[model samples]
Target: MSDPLRETDENVVPQGIDPLRATIRTRFRRGELARAYDWCLEGLKHYPDNLWLKHRAVLCLTRSGALERAQTAYAEFRLHEAHYDAECRALGARLLKSEALEAPLSDFTIQAVRAAEAYAAIYQETCSYYPAINAASLFVLGGQIERAQPYIQAVLEQSENAEQDDREGAYYLHASRAEAFLLRGDMQRAQASLEAAIALDPDNHAARSITLRQLRLLADHLTLDLTGFQALEPPRPAHFAGHLFAVGDGDNQMTALDEEALRVRVREALKTAGVGSLYGSLAAGADILVAEAAHDLGLPFHAVLPTPSRVFFETSVRPVSSDWSRRYDACLEHAASVQEVTSDRKQVGDLHLNYASRIAMGLARIQAAALCTRPLQILLWDGQDNQADRGTAHDARLWRLSGGEQVHLDVPSRVRYRGAGNEGETADTPHFSQSLRAMLFLDVMGSSSVPDDRVPVFVDAVLGRLARACEQFAPGLVYQDSWGDGLFLAFESVARAAEAAVTLRSEFEAIDFEALDLPASLALRIGGHFGPVHEGRDPIQRRQSLFGSQVVTAARIEPMTLPGSIYVSESFAALLALEAEKAYRCEYVGRLKIDSQKQRQPIYSLRRLRRPETSN
Candidate 1:
């Protein structure tokens, strides 16, 4: 018979064998777990003897929420006294600890003992090694690392006989050794052992955890950040939760920002941060501008804006906020109120004090209420304050209202200010203040043709591309709405919004047209407007937008425009004054009436290109 395993490529396996193992190795490298999991199950059936197959299956299954299956496979794998018995024992112990297993299984302990014996038996005969290493991890997990030192020393003495891949095993022994050092309060050796382990495997999660835990213990007993301390390993994901707050004052302060300024600020920020996520507070005057930036960039947004009454703000994208949990990436609330025709609608409402603060507070409360309705992970705040006397003595009271624990603020708690700082203060805080000026709204002219099934993928592609544009241009200011095609945006200035629009037009035209499955001639029509309006949700209109005639005019621009063209309202043009004439070719497009008016309205079309014929 042809070799069963060799019938397929050494890389590939025959049917009825674990195809998932091959796929898992591929996806693990590619970081595509979902598809890998699907293939892993198929592989598991045919190659039960393959240790690599079993390991990958358990990992993928656990990651994919088939935890029960993972646990079962783990248990079964433990039954076999394989060459990787020690590693298998450590993994099983970690799994058991994670699941809070109450009773110890005889098979589990028996397998662990057998594996330890196998290693010890090998160690006694190893003549090439100076130090011996053994099953120290068993003692570490069993809370008796001190008792495991003899075994670890024996394994280390024979380490030369083991391969380089056995370094992790040595580190496992070191981890237990470090724990022993700590138990004896021998800080120097504990630190040295951890350092050695880390030197072997930088991504050693176990070593990293123990090192930090030991450092924290030392800090509790001694002064932190002392002469010999290197910042407690890098802060992990688990460290940030409950230690941060997303705080900002309602500074409606970008009024004088021109298009150049908007682009400059955004561009500079991105260059500095590379790829950072923006979390703009909706109550800030920059909300609309940020949304416009995001729309122009084609990025997903986590809108924390609050609507008046209970109405959900209607948008083209499901607006998610840091409500419910840090993982709440998509909008959860249903339509509570939607303003319809026949009933007047207002998008902008009153400009209240601490608008941004109120919005943030409301977000906290919404998350809190939701948690009460359904138990979920603990919520956290992002921004933080350090000075105890800054009058803003960390709003601990906010947690009670939100009905959830406050997220720890780990990323230094400095106030975010736009302008100048006090004399002699650090250069980090600049001295220029900005004012809020205009809002830009973008709506896809005709989106009915987009197939519903492919909407999400297409939208993600488009929005992801736009997000890149924002990163290239605007950094911290952008928002995304839920309309598959339509996007609502706001900006600090008509000029920046216009610049963004022009850039957006050029970008859309230059997009990977093939990826969108559109003809070569396919393009996008974008509309924009600038005006003085309320930035937050309208309380009186139940969060319905109350944009003045400017919005309606801007909306009309798209309908009257061509694909891949940027449309701007006359009001925005006037704000530009002579500056507008220099940047764009302005022309009188005659007069047109808008949504709420019976009288004809005067409109002007500003094109970067002078001749309309050339544009066509």
Candidate 2:
């Protein structure tokens, strides 16, 4: 039940027609057209009046080269009297214009009858140019260039009147003029008109495709070098004739002996090198025999053991000029050093988003787990505690939802809140269940140097604020997990999550984040997804956690969200609609794929911050 157009099979009736139009423009992208068409038909049987579904089916049929069938289907849709007559008409007109039929079609066959009607209703309708345009296309297709002249001229005059003075229309008009000019061997005017068309729409795929063909033709005629404009760049190697080795208790690891063995392995591996590795991190090596072998073989001897080597010697180097503004600045001073290549790109660049997402997801699971089952508490200890314990306090926090309210119960004093379920049996309750789950997401903004003695204190302050906020709103909301910078929380309802997110933003933004020297201002982007999930009982495995497509999509939404924003799935928004009105902005981000057979589901973004004012 994701997309409204996605209908189940047994609901269909043979008498009903599926009006599915293809939106994917390329044949290569239509791999599942048949399946999509079938699905549309199933949907049509249940909702026979849906124009979009019918239009999509018609488009699919036409694009599959089933033109006659497409024509018939279009007629059927028109007979049913759907609300897409204008669109149907426009597509029909294009097809007729392309084919240039000799006999006039019946009124039902003319798809864009509305456009024709509209034109006639307007001041001074003329069929002279319209028919001539179609006639010229037919003549040109039949290889009768001379006979098409009058038709082409008639179209040019009519187009001038139809286009008025819009710049957007000028290029199309010029394009038609150029085609006629080319047919007549008027190369100068053709070229001029072609240039004008390109100026109007640089990225117009059709124009670009045609322009490329024309350029290639001109290149062939003049015997010119067109290779300079090719899309590919020259290849460069990380190291020339270098030993390719892998460590970690493997035979590939280098030893003090067996020079020949190492040399053979390196040569074998290097033979398979294509563009060389895009990026890599290697360890250092100080073996003299290895170094001597590299020196003798004219190979780059970069360290391959203790990371961050500084050697560079590779064959077939990329050429470069000294000018800084050229395609690539090849100045010797700025070339990648051996050490730079040895630094793992994943460790430095890839982990940021990964850590953040994992933290957010993990926290959401914890909250959900707590809500469905137990009175979970997140005991967060800071640097001060760590320092006092010599970094052994394991600064942790507890978050959970109990009773009908949410709560963030934390450490020190035993703060017990009355939760659902029987009294003594409650402590033994499972962490995850079938109950509704909430989500919590956190974003960290401040970085401060907290000595071992002071770290616990710093963590405590942050946890205290979170704990306080949960208490003020809903009780028993448990801490889910922490991303590198932020935290994730789970709740019983989306309203609770939305309220928590807004409150977190208001509180976090009000803080003096700059007091701690950090790279950038701290910010947050929060998003939540709700659906059926398998909840785990154990805190470690947390199987009761939100899993599969819905969770991943919710995680992705946060990245697309602006800082201090909270985005929810349409399901969550609908659930919240019956409660209090939300102050946040909402948007429909169309349907997204959450799983197989689930598509076009609505996603909503709830904006928390106001648009910023720019200084004049």
Candidate 3:
């Protein structure tokens, strides 16, 4: 659709000083909700009363699946603003609709009806086809077809009369018409309108995704056939993994001919999978081959390196051949984005590669979710599960556990590679006990504002609850410490860390601050990171302590996190994806500069997934 904020700017901010408006709009349109939300927050800091920015901020939260936060923000916005415009009202209704969709079955129809009325009221005030179509759809979903007829008729008439000069507007208009026809039980016209809508903006995957979902919902409710829409589905994002060629091994080493043949197979598999984007490392052998195929197909390649580029090149690329090294360099140069899972200057063990592979898979899944599609895993394997710790075998198994479609290209049995061998370690390299661990840092918000008299109450009510919760996870705790309002915890696994974080939040939220004579604003901000860390005995604490740059990174992430929310580093989220994909949900919250050094990391808001009920 045309920019709603731009059209309404005259009623909000002055034209000359509103340069941030365009940037925010562009980011939001590109599905970068976190970045757009950050920009909106920044704009509001300068112009606190800017209605457009407030609306956009709430919109970002709603789109990012932070419905509770979005509801709170919209409530606060309404408290500050005297008037509610059509856009603001529509936004509130959208929030209601989103929540209604997730409501329990017994409560869903009532909530959906309420949301439908809210949208209908907006449609009545503005004669907008967007809200009218939504009202009709929600009514139909709520089993109020008789009540939906008027709104459906209104949507059809208004959408037909609407201007179609703007491509986005035209697309939505057609989509609205399609929905209205479907509601009227005219399947043929609905399909034609849907096709027209898709034809108008074929490249706008986000918009097409919305249309597809609405149509699917209508088809499900009406028991209509929707198999014809399968062809319009968006291309899936992919994660790739394979063996790194072992150099100077004459017996089973892959020759030039084998490499070329493998590249052809990789390209064919990518094409057959209909992959729009690729995520993986850029190491020599199969990784480089996949990157080259992605580049040739004009697909975006996101490279996830286990360690720093120089170290990865030295260990994984340079050992193969100069030609392979050059190929790796070219892939890096052409990569859409390159993210290092850790800042380690040297490869420590198989942990780094394993971590990077999981991160790549998680990122691809994230991208696919955003596009309303599935993630595909492509592996080059020889049907052998030799390597147990880290290799193509381990990655393939992880993918299977995560429950996704995978394509395996069979490598010749003669291709013997040094899978997770000690090829990267040198004699001079000192080895210390190292393992991948999840670190958590938590700080109490507004701790300084607490009166000294109430400090005892805070200690009893707040810190006490945190201590009790940590005790429940004692078996998984690697290290734990608390001082004043700050707590640091190390967990043996990402699953444990995630469970602990969520449990702590739940425990704290259950506390009664008002009854304890403490500030109601008191809440905890938590941050987590997963990476290889040095485990050693502490001289001061007289206990085992976890220390490394990763721990420092986790500490930096805490101060930036929103109060009462758990924000984790990308590595932490990736581990959760591999180990606890079915138990936790990680929503991308954009990249943030975590320190004064200007180092940035992608952050995700973590929460537990609701379990499905079992039928008796």
Candidate 4:
């Protein structure tokens, strides 16, 4: 057997889903259901691996009044396989909703009974509100009203406790309540619930469509029934032209000709994939060429440095070429930001280089995952495993986990080259853009005073407590970083981020100092801020680091808080005020100036509203 794809292969097949977004809505709304259905079927032929389009095809077919065809396609959906998880099962249950409406299923039919059982399974596995509602709908449709009422009651109890700020969660909760009311022929209550659901997510196409249909049916004194499909927003991975790439090379110092050859390969791959950004460390060989190519294209090139700037420059950078330091400086100058892991001077050994490469790859993975795109790796090696230099081979394994293809730029001894890339260019200025997100900063107050032998135990205990606190409050902690006694975390919403800060204070209070620290001064001071952050890699650390004004605001607010208390910026307070399940109260602390150039920002002290224990 021989490998079909090689290092120089340029034939690239792009995976893009963004085109289907507007197409589905436009075609369906125009009453062009057949065309929409055809488009989906044709797309799946070319892209047979696209599960989303297959699901879309079934929905379009069902909506077009082709019941039998839709049912067959739905049954054959790949999601029904044993390998898919509860979430995928939930999606299937959701898609089945529309077809069930036009079914006119009788009480004695096998299909009707099986439909009800499937919904039950989905509800049991996911604990999602919609599935429970759908199960009740099935029972009601089969003239089993008594069985339906209990599910409605369960929904009411859960709705009272559900977090209202979860846009998607709240949408399903209110919509399901509407479905229950509709089943009972209570049009008034049903209409009100639908209105509430639509208010939560104005962009929800299904909610709007169903609401309009319900209004028309109510005016004509027609009976209400579900269309079957929940039509909540479908989860789609990102489809972008550009991919983040990594550069790794052997210990063999690449010559000027090797650098030029590498540049040609990198440039071709970037052009072929239409890459928008680059992420990696800046060593003498392949790294410099890729960086140069990325810079030439006016793309965002991020440089991840493994150690302190001067030490890294002194050993790994400057020694390669006196002019290499200037190129390194140029890369830093052009960067949107710089992350320095440690300032301590150390040898720029192979181990550090290996560690640095891993970090760079991690950053690339984070970027690709965030956009729902596959990560890419670009290796600079001759495809030889002579020694465990831990550069190209390690990257190849990492590339598989990252989920993308690779372009190996072979560095042979005899290689031809065109004119070399400019090694010195410092005149260029950087253009930067970063999205806003909520950040929480927690600094353990004075853990450094602990004896040298006890420091590790103290740090471990603090980290353990922090982990437990996050699991309690922020169930899905997305990003976190730490150094010494300080910890930094990031979240997509203000509610969870704020809850984490408040929970840390409350949870720490319940901890007795006698057990772990043997000191009373050890306490946690927390701060929270909501604003924009550049979620990119720290050049020194190699992993993703959150930075910018928001991060600075959070770090500054942390120290201002009273020991064992949480402080949040007014921006955070504004967001907390919007949450229906607000777990804490904030009293204005006053405006405090952090620095001379920075304006004085208002701060609020947060206190937890203890949750009452549920009666079992």
Candidate 5:
């Protein structure tokens, strides 16, 4: 049998068929679990009997935090299997372990012990070190250290005789040995084994992340010191920002020599920073140079475009030069992923560009969190502040305000440039008429169900509570209004909007419907977006209001948002990353249709970040 992890060639397969297994495996390996799960489902549509795809589908769902769905999928997968093999049994045990981890305090130990027994049974039947180590770990977590010893010994014994030729296999063996030693209370040997494991495959970020999580669990439960393991996490992710070259300005245009020098400087900065992955735009000048340098260094580059590809290329790339356009195309083609902040073809001043930059920064931060490391911002700046609120200087300021690490590469003195297209503007140039703002739309879930007699109660219990929540954020709240069950709000920043959304959701959930004579089904659905909106006074209400395409976009997202949860547009999530690095988290919930045109928009579930407790 061939190795399932090996890449498959599409040319070798029949025409008109996708290499589904290969596509899914590639996405899975890149840590794109959501996309991998999507591909698995698509593959299943064509080849329903494909066992490998079926198994991977369950794994993707499990890793993506859809435990309930994974459990149901695993059950269906087991029914299709002719026999209960080691892989099948291990997968079932894995699901049980996940559920136990997510279970409430009352049921944690019971569920953990049940999962441990399942793994132990599999280990006894197959003598597999994988199951043996898992059984030991789960047993420990279940508060049965004494019962965990036999399985720990089994793991050490089995791992000693396991083959070490494969890199992945060798890493796992050392990792298993480390876990076994930790279980046995042999801290010295466990540390040694862990060092060996990390040394064997330092670039295995996903594997390192899993090991770190397991170690954290061990440290918390077993009271073991984890200071030495801090350095074993993956390298920091880098966020790149720089000035755009002025194409038509003879005095400010970046020459070939300047371009090459900047590229060299970027390459050195990336290497010195030990960047594992890169996130930025694909604009001309410094952005493309960073992408090219990262690509040459074998680091993954994720492109976050402000607008559609064609429009961005025309405005930001092609106008710079034909050569720059080609370079942009090459970098974009080789990018690990490409995300558009907006589908709009028209550029609205510098709004979209600034939004895209913030999103890129947020994405880098997200990747760093996943790999258990911090994010670094690398700016190729001229060290000069400009009148415009969007550019290298702005980005650097934001990074500093967020208290993130940063490296500045000064632009060559000979290559002075102005803002892209605002060549004749001075420091006194007037700002854009529209300013970036965060807009939120919320709706009461069961408002329509209230009878005439209960209307007063519904308004008092539901709307009254919401009004109180808004009061807490009065400084950040720029505008607010209510019409029946619908509520509209505008905040000065994304961070404030996110905080308010989370607070409203939590407060609404805590409401006692029984005491208030209201239905238990009443809930709140909220959606948010960050963009440039026209701020003016409303004629009908005779009050200040925010109205623009962005406001409309925010309104559309609320209807698609699920009740009792907050869903935000991609731009909103990105800005949250820039403004509040560690205060919130945005999990991608896939693209959802937000309007009648059936045009789908990427949405994320918003939640407050809970700081982890330090182990004593």
Candidate 6:
């Protein structure tokens, strides 16, 4: 079989794209999203089939919050919608606007009604729960409450009959029920249903939006069911005995001898760590090496095949050799669990590779959290820092810098290219690449100004408590470092970081200030934002740390916060909008330009947990 992932030996630039693509890169890195998008769109006009321009333009549109436009571009480019099933979100967003909700006869309501019907058509054809929830939610939104009853009841029936591992869609059903009750003017039942919806899954954006609407419209009268929400059991984190994720260099990067050594190293690492389950992709190099070892050792393998089996075999598996293809096939056939993430990769392009990277890493952590504890990681890479793209070098550095322990094996062949008219090899700069992390900065309100003797003791207690709280939460924080008063943390998900902050706040509030001889209460001012940061060693401290515009932005937001509250940047709030399933999640305070930034960016305050307030 021809290797589909093989790069064409003939290197030719897409016509008229050199200068424009260069300009697009520069503009994109500088945060001129609209300008970059314009340049990319203009380039696309000249080279309509240019994948580079299409992908970049799509990214710009997404960052600029033109999600619908991004979706159109993704469809045009034959790429996955980039967001997880964004058509559903767009449909929900359109139908659930405040005015649309309040008036069944509004023009928006008509448009929403049609959208819901279209979604129902999709459900009829696909039988996926994604559209089913939309079908029912839309009926409720369109004031067809009776029409929603069957869909909601049907979903509940399915949930009751589903296997425990397959009940992922039940959360949407609860949200639909909430919508039904709200439309019928049953406020109390609606609130409880909404609470159940959020409790089931905090990442349900559609449900979260509904809850936020209720809090906004009825805060003076209807208290959010925070009590009920807390009472519901948390999403059980995945756990498995001896599970770990693997990542590293590609086939071309490692020679035959090095492959044997790597395989041995991986086998030893698994055995040494007592890993019984190995989760990663089925890519030809380090991924399969680990898998083969796992197979030999009887470790259950959880695989994420980014593309279809045949496509992956041709593009990713068969590229190296037939031996590799056989191994890949055997691994796939005998894996304990498998997640076919997508089938859109044409040539393992940068975007698709990045997407696969997320799936591989996320499945490792998310599934482990679901079935066991967070999985340990094993990153094998040559010490090269590839700025051109995210690969093993990037993945290894990120895995370690995020405070995930891994058995890192340095291989020489992957260090640099020595073949084909190249001089003696030399690796790129030993720098860790950048990745998006949920950056958090928390400061004890008055730790700096406290008595000199108490400063050390108080700061120690605060940091200790915070660290303990993070471990209690699954997929805990990457605590980069801490000063006398504040600490910096990085996380894979904003939901857990936000939860940790909220929990820590509550824990502190439960402490009596008088018991510690304090004149005032202990409180925390937290600032959180998500962005790309360089995961490298700090020059001054000589320790691994995250540094970038996003990191500094998080720090800038923290001191601006009111004590005892969580202050978040506009970017951070956007993540919450997508991930928070609970009501009273975040409220926009105002826009602040902050130190040196030209744009006045919006900021939001996440409310602390309080007793349900019924009366104003």
The TM-score leader among the candidates is 3
Candidate 2's C-alpha runs over 4 A off are 1-432, 445-464, 476-479, 539-556, 582-585, 590-601, 607-616
- Model 4 TM: 0.34
Worst lDDT 10-window in candidate 1: 335-344
Per-residue lDDT over 443-533 for candidate 3, one digit per residue giving the tens place of the 0 to 100 score: 9999898899989888877898798779889888978988879899998899999999999998889988888878888878999998888
| Candidate 4 Cα misplacement greater than 4 A, ranges | 1-258, 348-351, 385-390, 402-404, 413-616
TM-score against truth, every candidate: 0.33, 0.28, 0.85, 0.34, 0.80, 0.34
Give Cα distance to truth, residue 386, candidate 6, Å.
Answer: 25
Q: Judged by lDDT against the true structure, how good is candidate 2?
A: 0.39
Model 5: lDDT of residue 144: 93
lDDT of 1 by residue, 48-162 (tens): 5666666665665443323344577677765345645544544454444323221234343444444444444444554212112333434433444565577655544443244
Q: What's the residue-level lDDT of 402 in candidate 3?
A: 80
Kindly report which residue stretches of model 1 are placed more than 4 angstroms away from their true locations once superposed: 1-50, 59-70, 75-147, 155-180, 203-207, 210-230, 238-251, 255-616
User: Candidate 1 or 3, higher TM-score?
Assistant: 3
- The clash count of every prediction, one per candidate, is 74, 72, 0, 10, 0, 13
In the order shown, the candidates' Cα RMSDs to the true structure are 24.9, 27.4, 5.5, 21.0, 5.4, 18.4
The digit string of per-residue lDDT tens for model 4 on 537-591 reads 6789887677665577788888887776678876565445434223554544545
| Alpha-carbon shift of residue 481 in model 4 (angstroms) | 19
Q: Is candidate 1 or candidate 3 better by lDDT?
A: 3
Q: Which stretches of candidate 3 lie over 4 Å from their true place?
A: 1-58, 68-85, 102-110, 141-143, 160-163, 181-193, 213-228, 246-258, 419-421, 425-432, 449-454, 610-616
Which 10 consecutive positions of candidate 2 have the poorest summed lDDT?
313-322
lDDT of 6 by residue, 516-598 (tens): 55546557888887655567887998888786566778889888887777877655554443344232245444446566744
